[model samples]
Target: AQSVTQPDARVTVSEGASLQLRCKYSYSGTPYLFWYVQYPRQGLQLLLKYYSGDPVVQGVNGFEAEFSKSNSSFHLRKASVHWSDSAVYFCVLSGPNAYKVIFGKGTHLHVLP
Candidate 1:
């Protein structure tokens, strides 16, 4: 079975500051990792994904993620954040054969003025 773990339930960062959200996964085969962001009252939006090749993938805005097969981790990072970046971020794992998608509990990001 595949699962995602987000140790931080909530994160706070000052506007314009750098940010990094930790995520870890467990799966037997090569895992497909993804990062999604959900704004208040809106549906989830894909931030980025990882399967093979380059460990780092650029996402919307200034967001990006690095994949680590050995550590079983795929953490998201942003060079700088804005007030609008305040939202709930979810680390997801696609099941084998792409049968199902597992989403983490999510980490709520709060941006301070």
Candidate 2:
């Protein structure tokens, strides 16, 4: 079975500090990785996705994620975060059957001023 784990349930950082949300996945074969952000009262938005090609993929709002096959991880990174970036981030994994996807518990990000 494919699974995604977000070790940190909550993370706090200064308004202008860099941020990194850890994500590790377990799968037998190549899997699709995705980082989705859900605002306070909104649906999940696709921040980035990785299927093939470059290991490092750029995403919206100055976000980027690197896929490490050796480590079985796909961690999201942002050089500098803003208060608006506060939200719940989910690490998702999908196998050949895209309909059946796995989602991590999600990390709640709190950006302090």
Candidate topping TM-score: 2
In order, what lDDT does every prediction score?
0.94, 0.96
RMSD of each candidate? 1.0, 0.8
**CA error at residue 31 for candidate 1, angstroms:** 0.6
Model number with the top lDDT: 2
Which 10-residue span in candidate 1 carries the lowest summed lDDT?
A: 93-102
Q: State the local distance difference test value for candidate 2.
A: 0.96
List model 2 lDDT by residue over 1-113, tens digit each: 67899999999999999999999999998899999999988999999999999999999999999999999999999999999999999999998987869999999999998
Superposed by TM-score, candidate 1 places the C-alpha of residue 30 at a distance from the truth, in angstroms, of 0.8
Runs of candidate 2 with Cα error greater than 4 angstroms are none
lDDT of 1 by residue, 1-113 (tens): 67899999999999999999999998888888999999999999999999899999999998999999989999999998999999999999985676668899999999998
Error of 1 at 50 (Å): 0.6
Q: Which stretches of candidate 1 lie over 4 Å from their true place?
A: none
Q: How close is every model to the real structure, measured as TM-score?
A: 0.96, 0.97
